[model samples]
Target: MDAIVALHQRVSQSRLTAPAPDSIQLDLLMRSAARAADHGNLQPWRFLIIEGEGLIRLGQLFARVAAAKKPDITQAELDRFTAMPLRAPMIIVAIAKCQPHPKVPEIEQVIAAGAATQNILTASFALGLGAIWRSGEMAYDDTVRQAMGLSNNESLKEQILGFIYIGTPDADARPARQINPKDFFSTWTGE
Candidate 1:
């Protein structure tokens, strides 16, 4: 497939099915993720792949967090929270490791991580896999972060970037609304 078309077709997938991506596919995806552009060659991104029993554990953690925060949450809501990780056959937790570089600012390092994440999504799409990037309470919660062995210098406000779920689409994903380029473009003339 053409690179432009492959990139344009990449969409956030929320509905995925059984038979997670095989080891070979994962190897390719990881290699593709490593190809993301980085300033100063500081690869400040880390990916944690979670699936199988790990998904169940993640679901439980989400449920625990939800219940602790919202004691009055209904069983349905709890179930929903618990099942979030199970929605996809594979989930990659993307973390931004901030390593101070004299020549590279902290923000740039973080941006490199974000770029790596985009690469992961794009690669998944190119491989005919569905993908979605998600982050919420789990990414911010101290307890949840510890559960996943993620360290965040809260004082610095540095933490996990987000979660990228990848798998085969169980159902068709609704394409995002076409965006108008005009809304974001403006002529810049040095006067």
Candidate 2:
């Protein structure tokens, strides 16, 4: 598929699934991810590919974090949280490295990581795989960050950027997106 069409398809396929992306496909996707623009050539991004037993470990961590945060949560709820990793065969944990650079700002590094994530996502969609980027409390937890071999200051959580879940589609495609460029466009006319 052409780049434009593939990108559109990828944007529309931002959904999670259970089937995992193969090793070869993942390598290809990573290559695409690495091609993203990086200011100062810092390439301040890394990925931890989680699959098979790793998912089980993540699930356990998720359950622990959820339980600790909400003691009143029922076993069913905890189980649901634990089962989240099972929704996809593989997950790419996008980590942002914000080391200070002389000419590049921290935000630029973050944007580069975001671009890498988008590359992975677009490559996955072009390869006929379902993918989604997710991150919230679990990604910000100290214990979870430690498990992923990341250390951080008290104020910063080391920015997980995203969790890219990949798999084969198990259900019908989701609803098509309606794109209205006019609503998002702007003009430079000095008014």
Candidate 3:
């Protein structure tokens, strides 16, 4: 698919099914992700591929975290947290491996990691695969991060950017809505 077409029409596929992107497709997506722009050449991004039993363990970890917090969370609440990873056949946990850099700030590293994730999303669309970027409380929960083997700390530079779910869309994705660039663009004048 043409890059412009992919960029213009890419939409999040929330209801994904099995038959996730094959090895070749995954290779392409990873390559695309690696191409994301970075300042100071500090490629501060990494990914963890989770599927099969790994997904089950991830779900269990989420449940454990939730249960620890509330201690009285209902069964349904635990199930909901546990089922999150099962939403997709495959998930790539995008993490920012940010480190102290005199020339580059932590925010820039995080943005670069986000750009890498965007590349994966766009590439998935072009490859006829469905993808969604999902992150919420679990993503920021220190316990969850520790379960993922991330460094333990209140001010850790490394953090989870998102959990990118990729698979075949269960149904056709909604059409992309075109918004006028003029609405968001303007000429800046130094006054």
Candidate 4:
């Protein structure tokens, strides 16, 4: 698909199903992420690709975190948390590995990582795969960060930008909502 078309039409697919992207498509997705804009060439992004059993493990971790936060969490709530990662056949954990730099701030590094994730989303759409970028309280939890191998130490700050779920779109997937550029665009002029 044309880059412009993919950029314009890409929509989040929350109701994904099995049959994730094949190896070739996965390769393209990662490559697209590498093309994201980086300030000072910090290249401060890393991705953890999870599928099959790994998704189950991630779901379990999510449930654990939920239970820890709320000791009174019911069985059904725990089960719901455990099933979160099962919504898609694959998940890519997008991380921003921020490093100290004279010119580049931590926020820029995080934004770069977010752009990398956006690239993956657009590439997935172009490859005819469905994807959604998601993040909840678990994303900001320190325990979850450690579980994902991200350190919250003094020198280096690593953060989970989002969990990108990818797979085939369910048959009942909703259509993308129409957007008008005029509603969001504005011209700036010197007074």
Estimate the TM-score for candidate 3.
0.96
Candidate 3 structure quality by residue, lDDT tens digits, 1-191: 99999999999999998998899999999999999999988888989999899999999999999999998899999999999999999999999988778899889999999999999999999999999999999989988787788863444567898899999999998999878999989999998
Model 3 misplaced regions, further than 4 Å: 152-156
Model 2 weakest 10-residue run by lDDT? 9-18
Tens digit of lDDT per residue, candidate 4, span 19-137? 99999999999999999999998889999999999999998999999999999999999999999999999999999999999999999999999999999999999898999999989
Clash pairs, candidate 1, are: none
Model 1 lDDT per residue over 12-112, tens place: 88888876788888998888878888888878888899999999999999999999999899999999989999989889998877766789888988888
RMSD of 2: 2.5
Give per-residue lDDT, candidate 2, residue 52: 90
Question: If the candidates were sorted by their TM-score against the true structure, best first, what order would they fall in?
Answer: 3, 4, 2, 1
Using lDDT as the yardstick, the better of models 2 and 3 is 3
lDDT (Cα) of model 2: 0.82
Tell me each candidate's TM-score.
0.90, 0.90, 0.96, 0.95
Which parts of model 2 have CA positions greater than 4 angstroms off?
A: 12-19, 153-157
Q: What are the lDDT figures for the candidates, one per model?
A: 0.84, 0.82, 0.92, 0.92
